[model samples]
Target: MERERMVRKTEIVQVLRMKEGTGDTSFAKTAYMARQILLMTKSIREKVMKELYYCMEQPKILCIADLGCSSSVENNLMSVVYGLIDTIDKARRELGHGPQEYQIYLNDLPGNDFNTVFSSVTRFKDNLKEKMGDDFGDCFVNGVPGSFYGRLFPTNSLHFVHSSSSLYWLSQVPEGIEDNKRNIYMAKTSPPKVLKAYYDQFKKDIWMFLHCRSKEVVDGGKMVLTLLGRQNSDPCYSNRTGYMWELLATVLDNMVVEGYIEEEKLNTFNLPIYTSSPSELEFLVHSEGSFALDQVHASEISWDANDHKNRSSCDQYDFAICLRAVVESLIVSHFGEEIIDEIFKRYREIICASMAEEKNSVDYITISLTRKSRG
Candidate 1:
């Protein structure tokens, strides 16, 4: 018989988005950690701006894109993009260039809530006009819905590209790893083949990403990527990156034991995430040969990288809510919606139990690159 079908019938693009709305299930509420990653990479953003200053002279239109720009509760994530626009505008003006028009693209998967982002455009423009007064150049923002694994824009159309808390997501689940039953991601117990499958998928996706972006971004354009990563030189099975999934697996296993979900279904499920190390990223950049790596910075961020004192007091609940906002769509599609609340309830208990034993967090790597001039 042909190899067993491991890939599910569900489409990833339609199911991988954060919960839609401004509530706790919404990505806006749960993606505070992503915003924190953006803040942490402020220096990288500045460096890209400086590079852009030298790349162009008296340009009239600046094309910038925020890849994986999901909708937020307060539209704060776009504020990060807005900050990018402001910095680029300021840098151009400081170089004595006249006002330049801006074409901004906010990209995410088709299932994303673009309506929310579009709803804020008027307010965003109004704020820009107010902040810069007469100096503000007209800005046109549009939503581009597609996966970044392939070309999403025309060749040589973009100047600056930014993605934060994205890219760690593989294009799709790796092939052939479904045999590693009982785990939704790479874990300490994952066999060597399973780990290799995950790494190979990441390598291909990252390379394809760089290759596609190389064609889309103009020569000398800059791209900044902040990704979930591991600081350890080689952490294929490190707890820092896989512990959350391990706990999630525990919950799933228990659910299977209690007949809450089918064992085969749980065994077939696998998350499409793979945290990278600085060395791995560097090697990919070199192998791709289209962009020059400008800088790589790594830092550790707690799972609860949000304002707990202000938003909510329960750490376990906060963590569960954040994870649920992103993974619930997948879980609900694969396991059915009825089990979501109970699954996360069990998840929270596991998180609390893990915390009681020791604190947990993961490393983030910020990589800056400049597109080399086309030969």
Candidate 2:
């Protein structure tokens, strides 16, 4: 794992297939996020709705944006958006609030596949139109394809901001990391250089996100973010906390060494892996001075948990399902189709072995911040 690696994988199987966030591969996982959002803030959300009810009475129009809304409209993303949108409409209707005009900006990097997001949003808007029947009111939706690290909109212009399952990704790895070509990221033993590089990059990315949002958010604007995270830091990925992709990466690496695939094909491609807790996130955001931290909730979205327990002992069989689809897809895209089967087989064996050794837990941190009203 180079500190500063850029995506250059030429393999067809693994190219552009890595699971970056709460990916759509798992139906159960996706549903969990939708449900978790409701459960995590049932009371708080109710209060917000009440506030909005009064706010809707004002003559001022509302503007909201979902930053880093990557072009890929995964099933999970769509469900969350539609669910959120539906909830908002219900809030307005309950207050007898006729169409409080809202402008929603769906943002993502320019290189993202916007076709999928645009196509899906268009269809979703059509569905809404059919239901609303000429009473669409003032809600308008459009895609903003660009990076969020820079100012994408005017200051003091937004009323609300939402980024679900985004952030935690560094804008770039530390400089000169890839140049070393030492594979410092992957080592049997702890390497201080590699660890520092990874941590430093994470810190920088966090700052970029905070600074970027701080620049664009209006006074008193609210931002709700749901993203993947880890309970404790162990670069080893030993926690087995739904770290299927990491397992899959090991599988891919093994396949390459076994002569199942060419190693050179993978160096070109890189996947952004980020895991942090709610407090850690708050620290970074607060440090940026753009947003005032308000509420923080830890949602228990572990798929393998029993009785919906936030922490569940890892089981090899159940864990395999979560990791297989994601890892295999990523490998196929980056490493070519030749080693897909081998990679999967090896990955399965390793995951099972790890599970047999002991227990694992999966969890996510949701942080809600109120953007500081600009001076």
Candidate 3:
């Protein structure tokens, strides 16, 4: 199923591919909204850079990987990346010699649009060349779309890794727990079972990611992970948190009541589940037997306001757009891609009703770790 959806995601990304300077406004220019992505993990990245750049024995070449780098445009993430690179450049200059080469690997799920990423990289590359000609070195950039938790690169090869606003997404919704719409995760009146399911999946995936890095990243290499999250995962199932689950549950329940779908159909549903806390992340680090905890500071980052356009209310269509872009593969594989459009429409109806009153404010956390030792 995973492999099948991977192929489908690749197709969607290709279809939505944007040209250089043609994506969201912030992708090409740094706007207030675009600047928001840097909030979650800035402190950790800065501290890690000190250790990375200050070392006299640093490698002459750096290989970088941006996991979940779906958009061609750098958007808000560009700031963090460019900032990191510029800092390293400065440190090298102080030493009177720069690295011989540098490369960045942009990765996303198979369904992600590489063309968009390509254009973004091209524009950013030109910017770098204009500013620092000889010192910049060679940049070999390519797209790798696959689950980072499993495998994506060769052993002990990567120098650095960065991911933002993506990790909290679970690989799959837990099986069998969705029998009751009221107890489902991502729905209104969602039971604790649903939330717990998501938490479990996150723990598994984070562990997988850490272990994968242990095999692929060289000793002492660095990683920066910034993701959407909450201070705690356990929240009462009520509108106080979000109408997402409530509205979704209502929509699905109505559909079942009208004989539009099966009773357990909601079982296939998975919530956005983006909330994560520092403690959850720390446990993964210690038990995963992979990356070392260099630091775990909370970054308060931002994103373009459009990121929440549909989530702003119960607009089923808008919710679908956000869901499709973020988790389209899951939807297509589970419910049959044929009904994806209808699903979005139904989703928007419920979401718009929920978000009609309040403005959208999305919050997330960014964590950075060091590849202290690799297996």
Best-fitting candidate, scored by TM-score: 1
Q: Could you tell me the lDDT of residue 188 within candidate 1? A: 71
Ten-residue stretch with the least lDDT total in model 2: 8-17
Can you give the lDDT of residue 152 in candidate 1? 96
lDDT of 2 by residue, 90-199 (tens): 77677666665667788865544566666666676666667655564645777886556557888667766676555654555344344323132333243556556766
Q: How does each model score on lDDT?
A: 0.81, 0.56, 0.60
Q: Tell me the TM-score of each prediction against the true structure.
A: 0.93, 0.72, 0.75
Q: How far in Å is the alpha carbon of 240 misplaced in model 2?
A: 4.1
Model 1: per-residue Cα lDDT over 210-251, one tens digit each: 999999998889898998888876545564867787889999
Query: Which is better, 1 or 3, measured by lDDT?
Result: 1
In candidate 3, which residue ranges exceed 4 Å CA deviation? 1-35, 39-47, 180-196, 233-264, 272-274, 299-324, 332-360, 373-375
Candidate 3 residue lDDT tens string, 1-375: 778646643443443221123333212332232234554355567667757767536676677787766563466335666767777777777877755477677776665555656766778778777876756676667788776757899998887788876676556544345543543454445566765666676787788878887888888888888776555544443223243445545666676777765666655555535466777788778898677776666543222245433222222233334433444454454456676666657876656654565543444566767777523
Residue 277 CA displacement from its true place in model 1, Å: 1.0
**Which residues of candidate 1, in runs, are more than 4 Å off?**
1-10, 73-78, 305-316
Give the true-structure RMSD of model 3: 5.8
Report the C-alpha displacement of residue 159, candidate 1, in angstroms: 0.4
Question: Lowest summed lDDT over 10 consecutive residues: which window, candidate 3?
Answer: 17-26
